[model samples]
Target: MEAAISTLITEFKKYAGKDGSSSTLSKDEFQSLVSSQLSHFVKNASDPGTIDQLMGSLDENNDGELTFTEFWQLIGKVACQQGCFSQ
Candidate 1:
């Protein structure tokens, strides 16, 4: 679990830094991250509209960017949807 969390943090930082904003993920950064790293999880990764919609949904404060917390929430949602349960 620790290693998985660490990896998630590393990926987030890597993507966020793409746009020179090591604090948040811009639209392009988010798209690149999802398409390149989360292609297996996110559907239609190559669709611009899908990426835009996802980015909009994840932007809680309407800041047009995704924070680490927001990104984690998205992961949780995808996990639940994929039935990655331990029951």
Candidate 2:
């Protein structure tokens, strides 16, 4: 569990760093992260419009980029949907 969480953070940093912003994910960076790393988890992961909608939904501050907190909302939602916390 610890390893999985670590990997999530690492992956977030990796993608977030792609466009010179190690602290947030731009739309293109988010798209790349989702399409490449989360395709199996996200529906329509490769579709640009889908990505656009997701980015908009998760961009809590309407800043056009996703901070780690915003991005974590997605991870938590996906995990819950997958029953990752179910006993």
- Give the Cα error of residue 53 in candidate 1, in Å: 0.5
Give, for candidate 1, the lowest lDDT window spanning 10 residues.
78-87
Listed in order, each prediction's TM-score against the native is 0.91, 0.92
| Steric collisions counted per model | 0, 0
Per-residue lDDT of model 2, residues 1-87, tens digit only: 999989999999999998968999999999999999999999999999999999999998999999999999999888888886752
lDDT of 2 at 44: 98
Model 1 lDDT on a 0 to 1 scale? 0.90
Report lDDT (CA) for all predictions: 0.90, 0.93
Candidate 1 backbone overlaps, count? 0
Give the runs in model 2 whose Cα sits over 4 Å from its true position: 84-87
